[model samples]
Target: MRQPRKSTVEIRTSFRGREAIVSGAAAALFRREKEGGFFGISVKLHARVRLKVIVVNSVEYRPDVDCYIRVPDPSNATAVAQGFAPRRCHVDDFS
Candidate 1:
């Protein structure tokens, strides 16, 4: 007999100091898989600049894992416009 797949929950949160909320699956929050990768949320801040936010699960071999939000710095709009990498923001697990 084969084991059943685990059920996933929806996670929603707003970017650092942003009004928009990004939502994704609980299992593959910020992981990229070969079979079914989690899709990231995209938001446009300026006329020529857009940002993508994803929740990355960085726990290895652990029962309780922590998640983080990867997004561009809202304060550094000019740097983001100049094509810089997004920073990782820590997420608090209240459950």
Candidate 2:
């Protein structure tokens, strides 16, 4: 899949009735929306991309998507190992 252009850019956003569905990383705080049509959120972010990450032991091979996920801690260690954000290792790293 073709990855969307990844670039952080500042944007002023106005959410319509309910069409504020956006994807990608945001590095800003979104203020609360007003009653009528108002500026819902303004932030600095990257271009939206289709991201689907597989937290396997494999690092060299990632699915055709973007995911820099970090699972919340204090859950279960087993869940962490087999869950999100697995270590990215080389061939020699494994037996």
- For each candidate, what is the lDDT? 0.37, 0.35
Per-residue lDDT for 18-56 in model 2, tens only? 554354333122222221212222222233333345543
> What tens digits encode model 1's per-residue C-alpha lDDT throughout 1-94?
2223364545465544334334566434434421222234543221121222354433332123333323433345553465535445342332
Each prediction's RMSD to truth: 19.5, 17.8
| Candidate maximizing TM-score | 1
Q: Model 2: number of clashes?
A: 1
lDDT of 2 at 51: 39
Clash numbers, per candidate: 0, 1
